[model samples]
Target: MAGAQMVNSHPNVKKYLGFALLPQGGVSIGLLTIVAVQMTQLYPIIAAVIMLSVLVYETMGPVFAKYSLTKSDELYGLDKLNESMFEEDTEN
Candidate 1:
């Protein structure tokens, strides 16, 4: 969020601020792996927590990204595409 705030000064840039808030599980998981290897005592609990966090973030990240794009009006034709996917084919 701090990254977002830093770029929030510009009107156009503000719309893309959500991109900065997107979760990056790869980096977190990599660092967690290193920490777990270095400190074996806290490995189990810390690993569990980090895995859970990554799972939650991975699931919700797309939703947040889509919401941000929607709010910024940057989805283009994606909404239409999504809607079309759910529509039944009358000719079938």
Candidate 2:
């Protein structure tokens, strides 16, 4: 029942696909770069760039999520949209 409810609520599987891609996308690229650098004992510059990219994303991600989660605009938008639909259109 709970699984069915969740699927009903989140009708779009694209969200799940998006969540699956996040860590495996840019982060994977960075990890591979770092691993390659260590394997070849090459310039630290490439490794540094990869590490910096990862750190920047890690630092900003939570802040972005928190800000997004706390935003009242979502509730307002939902309420505003629902109100008109539920209310009779008197102008007609």
Candidate 3:
């Protein structure tokens, strides 16, 4: 997820993703250890599948966040036409 954080445009996205990844550090150690223990029994293709799935999942986060922010920006601007309706009159 370090790769995703590096390219994410939003600060919240990077910060949250960083926090989410912290626990994975320990989890990964255990997972890799298990995988290593069974290395001789595993097929080579399984390793490739694991790497590809992780890359795809990591890549989708930033892309989804980018589009989500873009959609939010659009929604935020939707009420601009009514902004003047609430303005106080300053005419003498």
Name the candidate that leads on lDDT: 1
Worst 10 residues of 3 by lDDT: 19-28
Total clashing pairs for each candidate? 0, 0, 0
- Specify the highest-TM-score model's number: 1
- Residue-level error in angstroms, candidate 1, position 77: 12
How far residue 5's Cα lies from its native spot in candidate 2, in Å, is 24
TM-score of 1: 0.60
lDDT of 1 by residue, 4-46 (tens): 5676654533766565356678987999979877989998889
lDDT of each: 0.73, 0.52, 0.52
Off by over 4 Å in 3: 1-30, 65-92
In candidate 3, list every pair of residues with a backbone clash. none
Q: Write the per-residue lDDT of candidate 3 for residues 1-92, one digit (tens) a residue.
A: 57756786456554444433332333444465677668846835555665665565566655655554454453344466456544534332
* TM-score of model 3 vs. true structure: 0.33
Q: List the candidates' TM-scores in order.
A: 0.60, 0.34, 0.33
How far does residue 17 in candidate 3 sit from its true spot (Å)? 14
